[model samples]
Target: MTKNILFIMFDQLRFDYLSCAGHPHLHTPNIDRIAERGVRFTRAYVQSPVCGASRMSTYTGRYASTHGAQYNGFPLRVGEMTLGDHLRPLGMDCWLIGKTHMRVDAEGMERLGLSPDSVIGARQAECGFDVWCRDDGLWAEGPDGFYDENRSPYNEYLKSRGYPGENPWADFANAAVEGGDIASGWFMTNANKPANIAEEDSETPWLTGEAIKFIEQAKGPWCAHLSYIKPHWPYIVPAPYHDMFGPNHVPAAVRHDSERDNPHPVYAAFMNNRIGRAFSREEVRQKVIPAYMGLIKQCDDQMGRLFDFLERNGRMQDTMIVITSDHGDYLGDHWLGEKDLFHEPSVKVPLIIYEPSPDADATRGTTCDALVESIDLPATFIEVAGGKVPDHIVEGRSLLPFLHGKTPENWRDYAISEYDYSTSPMAAELDVAPRDARLFMVTDQRWKFIHAEGGFRPMLFDLVSDPNEFDDLGDSADHADIIALMYDRLGKWGRRMSQRVTVSDEQINAARTGGKQVGILIGVFEPDEVPPAASSKYRGPVPTKEKD
Candidate 1:
């Protein structure tokens, strides 16, 4: 049994949603079991909030700035080595089973045995993932559209199957709860969801079936990546799961038409930074929280299936398993949904890695509060498989030290997370939500500073006292020195890691049509927002969307 790696991930899982962490309703047995068998890290973070950049960091072991894979459609700079490229020579078969959202334009094809122009951007080609399948695309679709190839994945997967106009609350309440999240005939959240999605018309069960086959047949010392998209959106889970978490413990979400206090716009302004819109607290709790948690339970069940397969095959002890997410869900926290803003629920995530061995002391079945970034995954897995990470290719350190019972106190004194809200202001797509130009921020254990120029005053939060970030301490004379120090830190770090966009001649021509500057002007920091706490080197954003 050579060291095989099973890297399993979901799209938008939240850190606080795990049952092991005390959400009595979550019931995530498999993941909890893995935690019991390995290391459950309480403070894992991702470099960026979106899929593309986050994947870049996970595969390359560097910040988006350092690796230059900052956004979707943005290719990694030529010759930038990824951990996969580093491991192939070591005789480890690095196989990707689903969704590697890397850009597979012409160049990406050569890496995956496809021609970019001829092939639609498939999941496998983009990120050098060997084997892949994209989970119901984009997480939203219309009624009877859950599997539709053309409609949004979210809409289709979430479209209700019960009688129309029925109270969603009552409909879910009628579902049965047996065996405490025990697998019935089905194992997902939305078993009752209508089939006939154009792409997955037959049944999603087939997808899982293929996965079982993949696990059974994979080669030795293999590194496999499985990307699950259930809990992402279109928040429709199968029947029982929809009602799984008794209403009492469901996490609260923002409500529609409820926002009254968010006066400031997109931390600054730019394209894609749609005008901020307001939603009420109750709306999120009623419509949003239920759907989101339903999806979580659904994915949780699927994860259980994956683990059950491992256990049945007796591979649980021989494999090094990791469970995490690209990023987290906003779930109406800070009056937002999706990952973009700089809120804790949006940036902070859960990271659990299990290497089933007894002598592997200090980490097995233990919890570590060390601050870690998603960028560290690639390097961590590379090491677990008994390979050395190349010096030039890693911006993240391996977690082997922590696993070996030697986590240094200052291993990571501070963690960094970056965001790029670079969309055109006059551009067609704008979030009808709060929009700001661009803002930068940095957070240590206690304070958070956000800098927005203009009437958008900088804000400082004493997280120790105000974890919700409800108050601004920027104007206080007491924290001026700390503010100045953070600004300098952001400057120096940004200078070292930020990447500039390099568009080809064709892309430049396309941009010229709008008479807008198509070239990406990657900068060290977003135009300073009045600063309280801030990340040093973040870039880009726009104005347009207005919060109601």
Candidate 2:
């Protein structure tokens, strides 16, 4: 009999939202159980924090550098190998049940049985999923079949219940000119909460039900890709869960009082922008985070149903249930919200692997602080399924070694990640004198660097000392060696990206351990940096932390 592997991902699920992660007030018991059963990775990262980009990297296991699907509008290239592709050929019956946000264009529309008219206000290609059940893009759909005009999700959801209005996202974006809700961050806050909690909401229950079904119908070695879009936005959960958490228990918002502090200007600008700026502690308490955690707990409660079904169907022992989020939600950790910033709160996500077998070590609740990524997930799954993960197809090495209790001595010194600053909405907001976009990053741990474009607006954070990521070592001559080394390493690593070179993990590791020195400042194991402004008082959890 083939093993049934359930790959579950929560949309915009932050790394620390899980109950097992020591979240004092979170409501995630089901996920907590999953952690208890298997391995929970502490420092798992996504390639890009944005949904489309992160999903693309996850689906393809290829870095954004080669994928070129750097942002939402950027389409994933055709003919790329995905987790689905690898499994399907092995007769795994891979099914994409919900939220395959892969931007299906006309050429790819037929497979999923979708048409141009199928989507109302958003562009949805039909063939994106093998068994699709999704609304318009990123919950940005209008009341397509439900109403007359384009309305906010709040309005469209209300329309399904006999209410109607313009799309809030659109409305809020245009509100400055329209003058309806000026300075009011209602769209992300109160307005969207009701729908989130409603059992009638299409996406949530649809996803949950399908997950239950997959657990029940597992006959053989099957792979079900269940993606949930909740805990992502609309900060709404149904009634009981909606009122699940009290405001007083929400964590405090963070602030950095360092003069040396200078983040990527993209984030700094958002901090100083009208709606942007580090959120206040009171804001994190009142209107900001409670709802986000509410949704987290909501996902937990729903996932509990899946767990119950697995045990009921007697499939618990034969299944390798993996739970992870595409990315992390920065719930005011550094004053950021749902993602795209190069802060720990945005990029890091909780990666919990639960393989229900008695033979699995009793001390299964282990956390690997070594930097890993979403791109490594597919290979690990393939390895666990006892299937052949083609050499060229898999990008990251298998976690089977770590999972199987083989503590390989001297794992790679670092896990490298790079993000091009020019791709975000925040970047266009600034029109610098000389138009130059610089590529930079934080290493396996700390010791950050930014290689400022004109060499004037630069940034560097000694993240070890300043976990807040506020201190900018950019202009300091004291850390000159670190700065120059980071820039040099950035050039080498950045060259592989911009230049498109495919080096094996062995080769990369060779460069790391074999002392075959290649590039600039190579980072060992450094701690992560905290983002700025994740929770806003007026906004739900959109701390307005802009990513570069």
The lDDT of each candidate is 0.60, 0.61
lDDT of 2: 0.61
Please give the lDDT score at residue 193 for candidate 2.
38
Q: Considering every candidate listed, which one attains the maximal TM-score?
A: 2
| Residue-level lDDT tens digits of model 2 in 1-548 | 34678888888887766768987777578888888888888878787777777787777777776677666666665445677667666666566666656664445445555455653112333222345344332434444642222223333444555432444332331122223433322344452233422454444555677567655655567777788877776554555555667767676655555431555565665565433443433553366566677667767877887788888877778788888887776655555555656677777788888766554575487777776778888787676666765645555667666776665566544455545556544556665432454344545576656554634445677768987776667778898888777767766655653322345555677877755333223353332221122222223555677889
Give the root-mean-square deviation of each candidate in angstroms.
16.0, 17.0
Model 2 residue-pair collision total: 32
Residue 213, model 2, lDDT: 61
Model 1 TM-score, all chains together: 0.72
Writing each residue's lDDT as its tens digit, candidate 1 over 34-97 gives: 8887788877888887777788888877787676566665676434556556667677767766
Mark the regions of model 2 whose C-alpha exceeds 4 Å error after superposition: 105-129, 135-137, 141-186, 189-193, 200-202, 259-264, 278-281, 357-359, 408-410, 420-425, 432-439, 446-458, 495-548
How far off is model 2, as Cα RMSD? 17.0
lDDT of 2 at 183: 32
